[model samples]
Target chain A: MSNDIIDGILEAIRLLFTFDRELWGIIEVSFRVSLTSTFLAALVALPIGSFIGLREFRGKKTLSNLINTFMGFPPVVMGLIIYLLLSRSGPLGSLGLLYSTSAMIFAQFFLAVPIITGTAKAAIESVDPTLKETILSLGASERQLWWELIKDSKKSIIAGFLVAFGQAISEVGAVMIVGGNIRWETRTFTTSIVLNTRMGEFGMAIALGVLLISIAFIVNYGLTRLQARGG
Target chain B: MNLLKVSNLYKEYYKEDKSSINVLSGINFSINKGECFVIIGPNGSGKTTLLRILGLLEPPTKGQILYYNEDLCNISRYKKVQYRRKFSFVRQKPIVRNTSVFNNIAYGLRVRGMKWEEYINDVNDIIKLVDLKGLEKKNARSLSGGEMQRVAIAMNFVFSPDLYLLDEVSANLDPMNVKLLDDFITKIKQDKEKTIIMSTHDPLEAIKFGDRIAVLNNGQITQLGTPNEIFTAPKDEFTALFVGYENILSGTAEMDLKSGLTIIKINNLTIVASEQVEGEVKVCIRPESIGISKNPPSNVSYRNNFKGNIEDIRDLGNTCHLIINCQSERFLATITKLSLNNLELAINSEIFINFKATDVKIL
Candidate 1:
């Protein structure tokens, strides 16, 4: 058993260092879906976040609380919702997104938007009100003021984006249920890991696991650097 | 011509628990074109609120502010922005943009649609004017409080808005920075086409800079007059103290038929005032107004004079406040440090405190 473990570790190293094609494919797919979905989510999230942060309106607190609550939603639940929506015979079935890369992206979007929005809101809200007043005093239009505020909070917003990306790329259950983990089409780092391990391809599984952790590390490191710079 | 008019302006702030604070109440004032108007008040006297309303940053709770005959208070936010661009409100503690000093100062002009080539020289000139020439590339947020304040002023000054609204810009600055700011203010004052309205808690600033001054206290305009008038004759108790009248004594008065003066009996001491009020009233005398002498200066008939023992001496930097006890009635008299040294006065020293009857303000 001990020898088997050591052999598996060595095999994992070889697979990673040799840039195994199948393993890289899994990585590319995982990152592609995560990057695209997170970028799209950011476009939708940032404005919502800033609006919620800056504007005073009825139901504002309730909306903020709902965003916060959604940040902690179970990944599998999100996957289930996307699966049901995109499944044949469901309301959104006509678009035929079920069991596809887009379906996985839809699930990931649901997972990432809340995290990004929640974090962006917190970051934007931390901005000094005096800065807003000063901007306004400079005769900034409303859009100009919001733009300045977002620029003021760019570092934290970027940190939040990185965190959301980390969460999206590491997510497995949602992508699995929605994408059906197709070999060449929808398989990702995490889904590939589960499949490779279950099928006794320990090297591929461990390689994907290592790459996943490296990505997570890079994201957290960026966050740490941002914080250290007092951003 | 009147450039701006604030009519019966009112502002209220509601708290989380539903309690509200009336920040400004029935504030009425107007600024003549090319005039320097100063609002003098202690901290939290609604100076900022009133300035904000005038800046078009806030709408008065129940009033109208007309800018060149246009009611700014009731105008839409878009319209207010258009009008607000005509003015810049420099805050007490300037919150600078998180950028370079040059960028911060250039922000106003940039927003005004000036291209970089059009505004760089102007920005550089202001940076030089503010004595922040070499620090143009430095991050404004990283600067000291004084430097950030200069940035705030420079940004506004460079924009050359039709009106400049400064909210206690010099209150917390060091002497060096204060001089720099004062020089900038004087420079701005040189431009006759630009009107400026500034607020300060310092009476001296009001006296030095204001063509006219308004005293605000507890959400109301206590008095409005030229600085000389506000200082020499504060209208009410609040205005009196606010204008640096340290000695406030409540007493009853009657027309003294023989002296032909209203004599206020404060704690068994008869103090004569020029005002003809003949009932309970408060007598306010600026400490500086009370002349202190080592001995009773000759013609005692013309002045209200009292021989007192110095109870305590408060050596406040440039001037000294002597708490004098005259026949058990305490009076505060301020004298220059030079006099304090020259007279060789100390605690328990015997001295005479005197002021003319006209110097006593009856409130």
Candidate 2:
């Protein structure tokens, strides 16, 4: 068993060094789906989060609590919901996006939106109250006030974005259910790892696992550097 | 003409449970153009709230705030923004941005759409004015408390607003910073076109900085007058105590037919006051106004003199506060440290305490 593990490791390293085409394609698809979803999620979440964080309204607490609840939503349950929505007999069946990259992007976007919103809201809320007062006292216009507030909390907002990207990149159940893990078109690093492992392709499975972890590491490192620069 | 007039101003803060707290009530004051109006009050006395309302940062629950003849509350949003640019407020605790001191000080000018090249000299001059010249490029957040306050003042001063509302801006500063701030205020006061309305709990600050001082206590202006009037003759007991009048003696006063002075009898001592009054009266005399001499000098102009033994001597840095027990009536007297040493005063030592009848204010 130890020899098998050692040989599998060696084979994985060889495959990685050789830049296996099929494996890199899966990785590329994973990044494409995750990056697109993260971008789409930020577009919706940043403003919503800022509004929720900065403004006081009648139902703000209820809305904040609802977002917090959504942040903890189960991935598999979200996948099931997306699967039902994209199924042939479902309401959006005419769009024919089922088992497509767009469907996978949609699934991941759903997973990431709440994460980004919750984090960004928390980030903006943590800003010093006196900073707001000081900015207002300085005769900052409405637009200038919002811009300064966002800039003041930029570090946390960037961290929130990184968190959303991390969630999207690592998410498996939602994308697998929506994308159907088609070989070259829709297959991702996580789903392909599962497939290789199931098919006794241990070398390829280990190689993809290492690649996934490396990607996560690189992304987190980059985010930490950005946060440090902001600090 | 009055630069800002606030009439019947009231502010109420409502809690989440629907309970409300009246922070300021019936607050009325009009600041004249180019006059330094200082509001003196203790903590939670609505000094900050009043200033915030005057700064146009918050609206009064009920009142009219008029700039010249125009009511501020009735103005449109664009007009309000335009009017807000006319004044600058420096809060009690200096708020610094997480950026360079230069950027922090330049924020007001930048927000007003002034280009860097146009306002850079002005910003640099303000930096020097606040004595933060060398640290302009340093991070504002990394500075010491005094340095941050200088930055806060420079930030406000860079705009050179027509009206300045400062809320205890020097409350937390060191002596050097306080002096620097006082100098800045004096320099600004020289500009006859500028109007300043500041608040402080310090009696010395009020006396030094105010053209007219407003004593605020419990959300109301207790007394509004020149600093000399407030300090020398506070209208009420609260104002007297707040202005550092340590000896607040209550007694029954009656007009002395022969002397033409009011004689107030308290405990075992008969005190003479300038005001001719009858019935119950509260008289206050400042500790510094009382004379402490080892020997009773003859033919002094002071109307009230008493023989007392030193009850307690408190060494207060540059001065000593001697508690004189004159025939069971205790009186506080502040004397110079040199005098304290020269007299070699100790507990139970007999001393002569004298104060003028005019110094005794009957409230």
Candidate 3:
């Protein structure tokens, strides 16, 4: 195990410097999949979160509870559900999107949306109600107030997106199941680590694991700093 | 026409457990243009809630709020925003953005889409007017409570809104800063002649600054009149006690036709009052209005002079409170301790309480 780990580190370092075409292809696909999923989730989550944060309604608690419950739903369960829907003999099977990067991206997007929306909603909702009243009393239109709330909560919203991004990029169960872990195609950093470990490429597996942890650390540190400043 | 008129306003809060509580019930008032109307009440008297409703920050549960005879509730959504811009609210706690003091004051003007040069000029003028000099670029969040309140006052005053709504803006201020706020309000009243409506719990503030004072209790207006009228002729027992703990004594009136003076008998003590009110009534006399002496004066022919035993002596700064037990009644009078010492007055010391008949008012 020790030898394999050393070898994985050396091979990962070599791959980083060589600009190997295959390595580039995998890295590009990972970025494309993760960034696209996070961006799409953010676009939908922002207004949803703002609306949930700003307004009160009859079913507001029920809606918030439902979203919070979804925040904890297992990714594997979601993957299985999607796989069944898009697999052959299933409802969307004819589209041929199962086991493709599109399928993997879709799975990650679904996993990420609730995290972004839930965290964003919490951040925006915690703003002092007096702030909202002051802005409105200054003759701010509804759209202007929405923009002001968003601006005031920019740090939290960014943190929310980063959390969603971290969640999407590090996920394996859903992406692997939906993408079929195809080489140089749908294998994200996490899926590649799993696949390389299974194939006895311990050096590459350990290297990818360390890289993922480093990325997660930097993102979280930056987020915490912003949160402290905003607070 | 009144600039703002609220009729039958009510607000209810429904809790999470679905139990409803009525916070403000059937509140009604009207303020004409350029009037410095103020409301004074104790905590939880719905002053802030009323201010919020007037500012259009929240809708009253049921009522008609009219602006220039146009029903605010009947206005279109877009027009509501248009009409709302006429008034501005300045909260007591001063919700300033985490930005420079200049920027905090400039934010309202910026949102109004004014030119940068014009906005800067207005911000400077407001800062100077509020006497916050040489601190324009300081971070607002780092400011002291008094400075923040001053900045808030300047921010709202700069806009020169048609109506200004302030909620206990002087509650946390020191005496000097309270005077600054008082002067600021007076200047606004004299210069702009803008309609100002504010809520304060301080009686002195109501007496000194308010043109007309409205007393609120249990979400309803208990009394509304000039400060002197409300202070002198409070309509109810609650208002009397609230205005000040001026001594209240129950009495029966007896008219002396020859002297044309009414004598009130509270158990055994007889007090003379100028007002010829008949039958049973309550008389209120401020402690300061009555005088105290160690011995009954030999020369003065005062209509009201009573020999009594000193029951309690309370020293408050330069003034000493002497509660005298005259027969079956207790009369509270304010006197200096110098007199207490000159008379060698102590607890249960014999003394005389004297005052003019006009000092007492039969309520």
Best by DockQ: 1
For every candidate, C-alpha RMSD to the true structure in Å = 11.5, 11.3, 10.9
lDDT of 1: 0.86
Cand. 3 TM to true fold: 0.77
Off by over 4 Å in 2: A1-7, A84-91, A220-230, B14-18, B69-80, B245-363
TM-score of chain B of each: 0.69, 0.69, 0.68
Q: What's the C-alpha lDDT at position A128 in model 1?
A: 87
* Tens-digit per-residue lDDT, B1-363, candidate 1: 689888888899999999999999999998888788999888899999899888877677899888889888667778878887998889888888888999999999988888999999999988888889899999998998888888888888788888999999888899988998887777777788889999999876776678899999989998998764566446776886677645666679999788688988887688888889887565678777899889779957545888899888876689977888888877777789999999999999999888999998875
Worst 10 residues of 2 chain A by lDDT: A222-231
Candidate 2 per-residue C-alpha lDDT over B267-323 given as tens digits, one digit per residue, 9 for 90 to 100: 789999988899865677888899988898699999999999998887769987787
Docking quality (DockQ) of candidate 3:
0.39
lDDT of 2 at A5: 76
Best by TM-score: 1
- Name the lDDT value of residue B59 in candidate 1: 70
What's the residue-level lDDT of A127 in candidate 1? 92
Give the Å error, residue A81, model 3: 4.9
Off by over 4 Å in 1: A1-4, B245-363
